[model samples]
Target: MTDQLDDLIATVQEQERRLVLTRFTHDDAWALGSLVVGLARERGLPVTVDVTRGAQQLFHAALEGTAAHNDVWIARKVATVRELGTSSFLAGLQARARGEVFEDAPWIDATRMAGHGGAFPITVEGAGVVGTLTVSGLPQADDHALAVEALELFRAG
Candidate 1:
């Protein structure tokens, strides 16, 4: 389990390093959010997607079959990314790798910060992580994968 966590950590770190944008804008948010929605629809995934820069939301969508609770999850995941400046999944993995519970940390509020997968930092070249692209409604790992896949597609174009 430790080895697997370590491997995942490494992979996530690599993703953070490589999946960087030259810049992020409202148009980029729309494109990325649409890509995620398209992919989710293709897979029949019931999910909510959100993109935000600081306190400003750029784009948001909730697919069919998703519930209000999914938005709650999105908020939590986004908060996790905002606070940690890393992928929420990576934060969870790093905590587990250290045999620590992330939410148990004094600075963490379990209700508003989820260490689960699905929220990814929107990193810009030379600007660092300026926002988050988040998804919810699927299993945590799948949600994370969907977000990553969309980011990869957006980066490729």
Candidate 2:
């Protein structure tokens, strides 16, 4: 699966380079959330999207078919990004590939840290990662792909 991971890492790095924001203000967050939600609707995806910076939740939405637990999963995925500086899916895969369980990671609390998928770091070109944009409710791979796709679409415009 490292081969697949290698590709995902490259895609993520490309996004980091392509999606830099000079400043992610409240308006930007709202626009981003709306855009992501629009995309989800178009694809008939039942998921939750969240964008947060530090302690501030900039944007949040739960699509039609999502349950409240999707929000819980998003929180866990966000925690994974906070601790690893990488997408949660990649972090989880790397941990398992190493014969380690993410729950046992020294720096994470299993109850709060979920190294699944659907969280991507929001990067500011000169400032580094400032926040995360996340989606949850699909299969882990699909969740990650959807987040990446959203970022790509946002970047293209």
Candidate 3:
């Protein structure tokens, strides 16, 4: 997995022509969040992404809207916290990969729609967390897949 991660990082750096292949950071999280959200929208998922504050703060407003299933949302957390919340959500999903579970800690209605999402921690070899890549607006499975795709792109650069 670490090798795969390294490959991913290299890919992203090569393609983006940037030097973020270090540890993932808040800035990366913001970029990842924004990119995935925009991609989702382009894919007709009707989503939004903002890595300004914590993930909760970023999506708090959008969740209030009247979007139906396939509606996407994203947010970047503080520098230290970064995408911690979103990462936890992704870990939980990975833990329960076999089935779907309804989670209420953040007070989200998981079953209302496909109700699933994921956040990836982008980090450089020694730079620490550069950012996060998160995606929502599709079934949990699809969301995870999309997130991976985005990460792959980021690394392929």
Candidate 4:
């Protein structure tokens, strides 16, 4: 990995570590989901962010739409907690580099797939992928933009 990738990963990992130790709620699913969806739309991407755990609560409805409510379907396991060192995340980076969208592409095996609606693992050098950053319910270019924007924010902070 390049020096810049290393540095960016380090910074993002530090932030994730802080959030974990502090039990921060700001980075929770609802909050992060809103940010991802809003940013994607701001970038002119059609977006729908499903919490994948939320029931059809009023709050859930207000957050995005009925799809945001996690109760309607067999909720995929929530993976909000940061996981920078996992093989799952590592594969995501490699897949992205190959010009393939792993999560949304159904051709990949179930075990190898990213479970979230469409998450792009944010990866950096030594730190690896810090978390699942996603932007979907849109065109490929728009989806990529959402992840890119999230990575930019991660790097900035």
Q: Which candidate wins on TM-score?
A: 1
Q: Candidate 3 vs candidate 4: which has greater TM-score?
A: 3
Off by over 4 Å in 3: 1-20, 23-34, 52-90, 94-116
Clashing pairs in 4: none
RMSD of each: 0.8, 1.9, 8.6, 8.3
User: On lDDT, who's better, 1 or 2?
Assistant: 1
TM-score of 4: 0.39
Would you list the C-alpha lDDT of every candidate in the order shown?
Answer: 0.91, 0.82, 0.44, 0.40
Q: Model 1, which residues run further than 4 Å from truth?
A: none
lDDT of 3: 0.44
Question: How well does each candidate superpose onto the true structure, as a TM-score?
Answer: 0.97, 0.88, 0.46, 0.39
- What is candidate 1's lDDT per residue for 52-143, written digit by digit as tens? 98779999999999999999989988999998899999988888888898888788999999889999999999988899999999888898
Residue 81 C-alpha lDDT in model 2: 85
Whose lDDT is greatest here? 1
TM-score (C-alpha) between model 3 and the true structure: 0.46
Better lDDT candidate (2, 3): 2
Give candidate 3's root-mean-square deviation (CA, Å): 8.6
For 5-110, candidate 2 gives per-residue lDDT tens digits of: 6676566556556767777677777877788899889989998999988658899999999999999999999988887778888787777767788778887788
For residues 39-147, write the lDDT of model 3, one tens digit per residue: 6657666433334322333331122222633233333212212523234244344334434343443443333212244444455565555444445445544655666
